[model samples]
Target: MAKKRSGPSGKRGSYAKGVAKREEILTRALDVIAREGYRGASVKEIADAVGLSQAGLLHYFASKEELFTEVLRKRDEADLAFSGFEAVPASADVRDIREGYLSVIRHNAEVPGLVQLFAQLSVDAADPEHPAHRFFIDRGALLRSVFADALARRFAEGGVAPRVPPETLARIFQAVTDGLQLQWMLEPDLDMAATIDVLFELVFTHARAASDDPPDGRAVREGGAA
Candidate 1:
């Protein structure tokens, strides 16, 4: 007798199933990297967890370098949804501002491995020929643009003269966040969220002081979803 054929329920291309498997493997891959470090983690290890052959893992990610970049990218996109991901939106209420920032701080506070991963990859990417060099640099530049645009819009809406140009502030914000993340990895107990809160408070306070007057500053609102 022949083995029974399975129904479409066992198929791989279904939207829900594919997404679930993708997330599952991606998450496992991230863990492997965190535990083993970049050079230590391998596709075989990831495949073992997923019950897939090494070749099967490669089907999902062509190479280790590709997997590494993609894992980081996925992590960042997810992290953005956490607390402390604030942008200086023109019409944002306190909730949006708080969530935006808290998202950043919260991620910094936890996931020391991710912080380490970013630092290692970034430094390694310094050589012009390094595969990830351009990707990392471009990502940094893009983040700076986000900061600048947000601050510019806020300044316009509030009728406030920004103490520093938006571009300058954006660069500084990313620099400080990256620096703090590096440090926090070494010292996991560091209150990253509080530090970031202080950073925001200082920036906002300076902006308010620069005006030499106070306006109806929006109250911060919490925006991170569970």
Candidate 2:
């Protein structure tokens, strides 16, 4: 006698299992990359850690580039969760945002391998045809938008006007962060968290000054009178 054929339920179960397995691969890959530098973390190592062969891992991801990109994507999700910035409330203080950003940097200082991967991928992703290109582009836009929204809200509510528009400030923040990461990679002793903290202080001070000075170059009095 022949064996029975499975129906739609079997297909669904298989699909669910495939998704779970892919997730497991990405999670394990993240750990591997974090522990081993980008150059050291080979596809075989990640596959081995996840109990999969190179071919098996490629079955889950289209290519090695896609796999590494997914790992970076997972890293971003983990960072957001760690910073708690995803759930920031309207009533939250602006300083909380600064702390969240600093915390992520501090965490990065501990994960040199992921940082290396990010740097390499970002530069390579500059090519339009690269697998990680879309990921980098989308990540930049999303991060800038989130930062801008938070800054705009805080500036309006706190009565402090920034020297630059919130959108521009957001770009500046992003650029400074990327630059600092590159610099830190070169100089392992660089205190990224401290540097960013000082940057936040400078930004806030300038914003406060901008808020205090009127358009006519007159300083606003204590009670808002020019």
Candidate 3:
């Protein structure tokens, strides 16, 4: 038998390189989409934004749909950044929640355009024929479940309280974030971070009263109310 070519590593390297270039193109392309609606965004347009000729951009991305799909996925992976948030004990003080909330607000500011893009594309991803349709739907469901679990864990100790059942509160959590993002997108001049801070303030105070928990650790230090 003729010797079989053993070139798996070469194929793997090629795949990795292709993926890297695709991501680079999509990373730049998202900004283009954010500024220009999907109708206005074409391969040539994105290529121009990144200083690439239309042909060169097309060589890496075969179609506008492919480019947009990759951009949406990259945006999700970037924004699904809630690490260390769940680590705060169910009994964590108000200060922990306050700090974690601040971190989330800071990250949103860092990617204002990307956040706006998601708020727009979310509707597009609902159609079954849309490339990212199923992915977005499934992701939304998973996120809701995960957040609900976190709320449940937090309240399980009886030291924490939620105005409604964790399941209902979970839906409220998603709705509030979505509505805020939409409003902020419409009016970038709005102080989204400050508004978020106020919302949390009200929520925490109510939870404290219902759970009969002590004031936050930092509140004790700064003479602030939880």
Candidate 4:
């Protein structure tokens, strides 16, 4: 019989394996970085945790910056999943989204090392040539867009009203969240989530007031919709 060719299936299997290993490395890296601050989580340390040599780890990523950028990307995906943004309801209530956002902030408090890493990388990524510069730029715009879009929906459908424009409010929220991370790092006792909640209340006072009104009022505003 003629020799059989493994062909595309072989290539696909190898690609799948490579992807799985990369994910494993990222997951382990998150644990290592969460336990050990960015300064402590050296390349060799991450390599050792993943049972790979420095060379092997480096082979997977073009550079350390690329690896860290991927780490932040993974963190974002995990955060979205945790915050219920991955599967938000078609008509999600503002209160529901607010709680989801607060939950993510609360989760961040438990991962101080990651926050430290993020703070450091954010500063470093300010350089346009840095590997993470694009990531941060794109991430910021996307986050602001998502928040703005969600608020716009609420304003139109949920009868919520805010003094500021949705886009501006989104930018303010992002700024506050990022600034709070730095403050929380300096003062561990800072209640970042609660502070954000208070900010939300102050900015969206009308939203809260509307939600609090009797069912009759909400029904009229929402046209008896959920």
TM-scores for all candidates: the values are: 0.70, 0.87, 0.66, 0.83
Task: State each model's C-alpha RMSD to the native.
Answer: 8.3, 6.9, 9.4, 8.1
1-226: candidate 3 lDDT, tens digit per residue: 1124533558786787667667778877877766675557777888887777888877876465556767878766654546355566655544455566556656675566557566666777777877667767777676566655665665665566554565555465566777888887678777766776775566555655756655455332221112
Instruction: For residue 119, give model 2's deviation from the true position in Å.
Output: 0.4
All models: lDDT? 0.67, 0.83, 0.64, 0.82
Who is ahead in lDDT, 3 or 4? 4
Worst 10-residue lDDT window for candidate 4 reads 217-226
C-alpha lDDT of candidate 1 relative to the true structure: 0.67
Judged by whole-model lDDT over C-alpha atoms, candidate 3 comes out at 0.64
Per-residue CA lDDT of candidate 4, range 83-193, in tens? Answer: 988788756645557888999999999998899989988998999988889999889888777777777777777565544467777777888999999999999999999
Q: Give one digit per residue, the lDDT tens place, for model 2 in 149-182.
A: 7777778877876656776767778888989999
Q: Which is the winner by lDDT between candidate 1 and candidate 3?
A: 1
**Total clashes in model 4, counting residue pairs 3 or more apart in sequence or in different chains:** 0
Stretches of candidate 1 above 4 Å error?
1-24, 31-42, 83-90, 93-95, 212-226
Error of 1 at 217 (Å): 29
Best by lDDT: 2
